[model samples]
Structure formats: C-alpha cells, structure tokens
Target: MSDFSGIWIPLITPFADGAVDHAALRALVRRYADAGVAGLVALGTTGEPATLDAAEQDAVLATILDAAQADANAADAADATDAQRRPLPVLVGVSGNHTASMLARIEQLNSLPIAGVLIAAPYYTRPAQAGIVAHFSALADASAHPVVLYDIPQRTGVRLELDTLLTLAAHPRIQAIKDCAGSLDTTLALIRDGRLQVLAGNDLEVFSTVCAGGSGAIAASAHWRPERFVALYRALTEGKLDEGRRIFHALVPQIQLAFAEPNPAPMKALLAATGWVRNELRLPMTRASAALTERLAALGETLPR
Candidate 1:
C-alpha cells in the first residue's frame, strides 16, 4: 500500500489578478517542501477544486509537481538531512457523484507521477451502502495509483459507515482514509483494524490522531507554520508525547480560528500576511471577513517562526 502517513498539506490554490497565480503557487510548494511535509494534496477541498475549471485545475497541479521537482534537485545539492528535499509525494483529489465520469477522471490521472489519489464518497445523492461500495470499488480498480478514501460527512452529506469502510479496506487498491467523519468510535476502530492508513482530515485532530496510533493528517492550518506542524508529527512519531502535546496545545486556538470562516478564507488571509499570495478566492467564496482577519492576526502570534 502507498504510505499516506505524516503531515500532508492540502494546499490552497493561490490566486492573483483573476487567475491562478503559478508563481505564488510554485513558491508555496517549495516552501512546504523545504519544511519537509510528508506530501501535498493538490486540488483538495482547501484548494477550491469546485471553483476551478478543468484547464485551471490542470495548470495548478502542473505548477505544484514542477516545484516539487525543483525542490528535490536543490536538496540533493545541499545534502539536506530531511526528506523534504527529495521529490515530495503529491496526491490529487478526485471526487464526483457520477460513477462513469469519476472513473474516467481516475483513469486520466493514472499517467501522472502522483503517489495516489484522495477520493471521497459520492456526494448529495446519498447512495446506499452497497452502491457506495460499488462506486469506490470500480474507481479503485480503474485507478493506476493507490486510493485514499475521504469520509467527510458534513460536506458530503453522507457517511461511509464503519462496515462499508472495513469492506473497502480489504481492497488492494484502496489503501488509506482521510477521517473527517467526526466519530471518534470510527476513527479508533479503523486504527485498531490496522488495515487502511488513517489520516486525520481536520487540523485540530492531528496530534490526537497521531497519538491514538493512527497516521498523521491532511491538514490545511499547517499551511502557515508548517515546520512546527512537522515538528509535532516528529515528536509524536518518536514517542515524545509531552513535547508533542505542548506544541499541539499551543496551536489549538489558531487551528480553530482558521476554519471559523469556511476554510481557506482565514487560512489564505494568514498566508497573505506572509506576502506569499493575495487573500483572494473565486466567486461564491469570498476572503475572510475584516473582523476575522484581525482576530486571526492576534492568534497567529502563537505560531512558531
């Protein structure tokens, strides 16, 4: 199975001048690479995949892969100690309600050098458990890369029940899961099963997940103070519980605030403060409110330099 452990950032697509900002996008990828993130998930929910058209989405992904390659080369030259310098593994997020369309999309991504894909349950339609099983099974069978199932019910409106998840875990192609089901029972059960790698989809759950014998996280809050996030992962992985808990405690407040304004808004606002990219989101998605921004700045002081 493909390893989906450690801290993975679901990058927010940087926009400027009413188009995808490839420059800022590449720089952001390089920054994460330097911080030694386990990998990155391109076009994930945080990346605003729904708002981007096919061409724009393709361009955004190309930029990230390109940056990963460049960062790998620099790391080799500098003899960097961390794995961040290596060609970072990249995961593409692919989801849809249409089975045929979703299968085609997975097939299309088979050619990329991605480690695997992060897929979600069919949304809105709320298909039966058997239908859901058939849906993901077919997609995983068609995909060349490993599959990481996403179980985020709040956004998808349907949950992949524990039985369904265990069944899917038996599939060779279906490897890991992004656990946003908000059910600690499911989280701990899946971890106990020890089949699929369980990655916490929520930022606030990263530390607890790691300490709970599950894998790391696919976090959006780590976009700002990424290295500290990495350190926490290391501390937990190395069994430094006290150290890990301390870092996690300090980061709890900011992590909560980042999602206070509907993801990627407050996150982008904080990133913009770093001058990495403008705090802009596409239509239907606005920037974090002025009040939220001010509150965020005050909380951001707790982040590591």
Candidate 2:
C-alpha cells in the first residue's frame, strides 16, 4: 500500500486562454517533486477539476505522471530498475453524488498508474450516515487502488460522523482520510485508534494534526512554500516541536492569504507573479484581487525559499 503520510500538494490546475495548460501543469509537477512533497493529488478541489472536461482531466493526469516519472529517472542511477526508482505518487480526486458513476470511474482508474483516489461523501443529496457508509463501502470495494476518504463537510454538506468514519475505517482498502471535517476530537480519535492514517485536509490544521500523531496533510496552501510545509511535517514527526512551531508560524500568514479568497485564486495570483502559471480561472471563479495578490507576493518573498 502507498503511504499517504507526509505533506501532499493538492495541485492547482493551471489554465491559459481558458484552457488547460499542459506546460504549466508539468512545470508544477516537477517543481513540487523536486521540493520533496510526499505526493501529489491531481483534480482535487484545489485543482479546479469541475471546470475541466473529461479529456482535459485525463491529459492533466497524464502530464503529471509523465513529468514525475521523468524527474525520478533524472535523479536515479542510469541502471536503476523501476522498483529502485521512486516515482512520486499521485492521487486523483473522484467525487460525486452517484455511486454507479463513481464506481465506473474507479474501474477506469484501475488501469492508471496513480497511487489512489481521494473521494468525498455524496454531495447535494446529503445522504444519511447509513447511505454515506454504503456509498463509500461500495466505492472502496470497487477501487483497485487504496481509498482516501475526504471529509470536508463545508463542501459535502454532511459530516462523516465519528461512527460513520470508524465504520468505514474497518475496510481494508479505505486506508486514510483527508480530514477537513473540522473536528479535532474525531481527528484525535482516529490518530489514537490507528486504523486509518489521518491527513489534515485544511492547510491551517497541518501542524496540529501531525503533532497529534496524525499522518501529514493534503494541503492546498503547501503549493506556495511546499518545502516549508515538508519541513514542518518533518520537524513535528522527528520530535522537534519548537522547530515545527517556527515553520508553521511562518507559514500561517501565507496559509491565511491563500484562503483569504476562495481557493486557487490567491494561490494562482501568487504563482502568476512568479511566472509559474497564468493567473486565470474558469467561469464562477475569478483571480484574486490585486491587493491580495500584491500582499501574497510580498509575503512570499519573506518566506524561506
């Protein structure tokens, strides 16, 4: 099983002229892989996957996988076998209200080289806990890769209750969770129980979660100062609380700014300033305000590179 621990970047899908920019996407994959993130989560909420058509999504995943493999090859010995080379793991996000569609999607992913799928509870329908359990159970059974349960109630409109979470954790394939449920008690409980590896989904909570013995994070904010985020996780896991706290404190300002506006806007704005990607988003989502962008740029300069 792939270890879903350490810091993972839920990538932002870069767009140019209102279309997916393969060049920018591949650049991001190489940058993060070099910076040492634990893995990458393509098409996560941060990636603006909903705006992308099916073909574009497939291309984006292919680009990420190809770029990561290329990076692995470049770093390893010439004679290194595939098993000896560490290809960066990438998790593709799959979420929806329909079970059969999700199952079919997972079935399709069975042939891909991705690490796993990140799934959330059914949205819009607001299924009851029983239904949520049934939904995830069926998906887990169908998935050839390990499952990372995404529990962001704000988006899903329903909480994965403690019982529901514990129930789902019993499944062999449901190995971890992206915990944005905003429940520290539940986070602690899962960490203590040791059934599922708990990865903090909210960027701000990464420190506390890792400190509390949770795994790491699937942080959107980490896209900015990814090395710092990785360092913070390393410090906390290695019993260096003071060092971890320092790194987290430095990153809090950026994290706050990243989410100051809804999602990838502030992040894209910053990346644009740095020429990493164009600051563009699809309809219903726009770029961050100029003021916020400037602030992110200035603060980004102050952060350790």
Candidate 3:
C-alpha cells in the first residue's frame, strides 16, 4: 500500500477574472511544497472541482503536477543530499454517483502517476451498505492506483458503517481512508484494527486522530500555515505530545475561521489578502464575506512566521 501519512494539503483552486488561474495555482503548489507538506490532493472539494468543467479540471491538474515536478527539481538541485527534496506524492480526487461513469474516470486516472484516488460514497442516492461496498469494490478493482475512502456523512448523507469499512479494508486496492464520519468510536475502531491507514479528513480532528494512533490528515485549513501543520504532525509522531498540543492549540483559531464559512472561501480570502491568489469563486460559491476575511487575516497574522 502507498504511504498516505503526514499533513497533506487539499489545495484550493485559485481563480482570476472567472477563469482557472494556472499561474496562481502553480505558485500555490510551490508554496505548499516548500512548506514541507507530505503530499497534495488536486481537484478535491476544496479545489472547487464541481464548478470547473472537464477541460478546466484537466488543466488545473496538469498545472499542479507540472509545478510539483519543477519544485522537486529545484529542491534537489539546491540540496542533493536531502532525502526530503524528492518529489512530493500527488493524489487526484475522483468522485461521482454513477458507477459506470465513475469507473471510466478511475480508468483514466489509472495511467497517471498520482499516489492514489480519494473517493467518497455515492452522494444523494444513499445506497444500501451492500450497494456501497459493491460500488467501492468495483471502482477499486477497476482502478490501478490505490483507493483512499472518504467517509464524510454530512456531505454524502450516508454513513459508512464500521462493518462496511472493515469489509473494504480487506480489498487489496483499498489502502487508506480519509475519516470525516464524525464518529470517534468508528475512528478509534479503525485505528485499532490497523488494516487500513486512517487519515483524518477533518481539520480540527487532525490532532486527536494522530494522537490516537491514526495516521495524519488531509486538512484544507493547512493551506494557510502548512509548515505549522507539518510541524504539529512531526511533533505528534515523534512523541513530542506537549509540543504538538501547543501547536494545535495555537492553530485552532485559524482552523475555525478557515471553515467558518464554506471551505476555500475563507481560505481563498486569506490567500488573496496575502497576494497568493485572487479572491474569486465561481457563482453558487461566492467569495468569503468581508467580515470573515477580516477575521481570517487577523488570525493569520497571529501564526508564527
């Protein structure tokens, strides 16, 4: 199974003049790469994939991959002996409610060099447990890349039962889980079982999840202060509990404000204020409010430099 641990950032797709801002997106990828993030997830929910058409999605992903490669080469040139200078693994988020369509998407991804695919339960349909299992199993079977299950019931309107998860864990292709089910019992259970790598999908739960023997997180909030997130992950994994706790406490405010509104809005706002990307989101997903942006800016200033 691929090592899907540490603080991975689900990048927000930057926009300018109502188009995908490839330049800004590449810069954002380089920023996170330099911050020592474990990996990157392109076209995830945080990236506003829903708002982008197929061509735009493909372009955005290509830009991210290209930028990451460039960043890796630059780092290797600067420090050939540094093991961490190697290219960061990149994962593509593929989701859908249709089985056949989703299969085709997964098949297309099979040829890519991504670390894995992050898939969620079929939304809206809320299929039965058996159906859900079959859905993921077939998708995994079709996918050449490893699968990372996303278990967020709030958005999917269906919970992946513990038994269902255990069953999926048995599959060779299904290797890890992005746990956002909001059930501590299930989270701990998966951690205890130790079959699949459990990555905390919730930003706030990153601390608890790592402390409880789970792997790391795929936090959207880490987009702002990724180094601190990486530091916190290292602290926890290295038995520096006190240091990890302190960093998490300091980060709680920023994390809360990042998600104070729908994801990527406040994130985009802060990034915009800092001149990283334009503060624009496609219609139906507006920019973060002035008030929230102000709060986020203030909170961002408080983070360590």
Candidate 4:
C-alpha cells in the first residue's frame, strides 16, 4: 500500500574491526535522512546483508527503525517552520538462495517497523519464471507490509521476465520493483504499460528510465552524492530535463567509481575517506585497493551540493 515511487538509497553497512559499528550505522542513517532521501533500505546488497548473521541483522534493523521513528517525531514537531523535515521510510532487504529460507526470513522481519520488504529473485537456484511468480505471490500474501520485487539478473543469475513481472504486478500486496535488468526494452515495456512503479536499480540508467516514464531509483552511488541524485529526481519531477541532465553528467564519474570495484567495498572506502564510516568490511569482502580508495576520495571532493 506504500507508494514507493522515488529515490531510495540501499544503505551500506559500516564496519570497524570486523564488527557492526552501531554508532556509525546510526549516524549514517541519520545522514541519509537529512540528505532528503525518499527512503532508506537497510541490509540490502550495499549493506552487505549477506555478510551479517541473524542476530546482527535483527540488531541493525532495530537501530535503524528506532532512529527513523525518532526522526519522524522530530519532523512532526518541526512541521510549522520547515516543510523539508520529514522522516524517510525504512525498507529492509530480505533475499536468499532458497525460497523456504526466504519465507522464514520474511516471517521473522514481520515484527519490524519497516515500511516494506525488498525481495530479490531467488539466486543460484535459478528457478523458472513460473516458480519465481509463485514464490513472490506467496511472499506478498504472507508479508504484513508491502513487497518490492528486486530483479537484478546480473547478480541474481535469473531474470524476472516481462510477462511474469506483469502477472506479479496484479497482486495487491506487490507494490513496486527495484529493476536492475539493465535493458531499455524491458524498462520501456514496464513504463509503457504504466502498471508497476519501476525504480532504476542501476545508477547509470536512472536518467533514461525517468525520461522513459519510470518512477525513480534505488541507487548505490546515492549514498555519496545524495544531493545530486535528489536534485536529478526533483528536476525530472519539475519537468526540467536539461537541468537534470547536467546534474547526471556531473555525477557520472562518481557513479563509475562506486562500482569500479565490487559493491560496498568501493562504497565503504568512499564513505571512510569522507569520515562517514570506518573503512572496513567483513571477511570474503576486503577493503578496496589503495589506488581505488584515493580515486574515490578525489571524486567525493568534486561532488556538488
């Protein structure tokens, strides 16, 4: 029932000494909220949710929800003076390789104060399109909150096809999609139909997708250049395409470095360089190279407000 039709940042997990840095994590969430993000997605790919254990996931979600509620209360108090102050919605990502495990995870998350769930298409198992539809349909019915489909074929190894996506859209509990299929044709098909709100999961495709009548993005790079991404979305909404393109071009380099290495490694390094979070990651995902870190730092310096 939530209208997820704007920019949401898939927040990165902050680490210090191979542990979840709760203080730093809270600060980062506050920063995203203050930066005017439409929503915050905790424990997504960028959050390195896969690296976290069950306890850590629960703790992180609690911290994020607590801070979000506080912020919402603050915004309500400040409504008389600053219309800009509003609490951003919190979205938790629940993705796994097994359908049953994912269902269990969704059940566990039902108690959280999250606005909705972002469920990635089952990875590695590569279930058929029909299986994918059935799995999501069951999840939508089970979830207490709305469900946002995550279709990043490059990472998940299985694409949620157009027909199946259309079918899934009709389900009342299914709200929107984090579309990372990286295909203009597929994006256009969804937009032309005007059924589901299409969020560009890939940063580079955001401008085109918005121009093509899609909703907005859930950008990884938005963690760093939050204002620029916000301005792009606002410009598009205001029908100022030329201004939006200028901001988009200015951000191309930063977006490139955000993914220059594998995901949160590069993003974490960038955040660390800016003193936002400590430059650390759990095992199996090490810090970025010295050169990449330096480049990200330089790119961070060039970003506009």
Please provide the root mean square deviation of candidate 4 (C-alpha atoms, Å).
1.7
lDDT of 4 by residue, 45-96 (tens): 9888878999999888888887766676676563422312555688899988
Cα lDDT of all candidates, in order? 0.90, 0.90, 0.90, 0.85
For residue 233, give model 3's deviation from the true position in Å: 0.6
Clashes of each: 0, 0, 0, 0
Task: Report the Cα RMSD per candidate.
Answer: 1.3, 2.1, 1.3, 1.7
- Stretches of candidate 2 off by over 4 Å are 76-85
Worst 10 residues of 4 by lDDT: 78-87
Q: What residue pairs are clashing in model 1?
A: none
| Pairs clashing within candidate 2 | none
150-192 in candidate 1: lDDT tens per residue?
A: 9998988899999999999999999999999889999999999
Per-residue lDDT of 54-173 in model 2, one digit per residue for the tens? 899889889988987887777557875442257889999998899999998999899998899999999989989999999999999999899999998999899899999999999999
Q: What does the lDDT come to for candidate 2?
A: 0.90
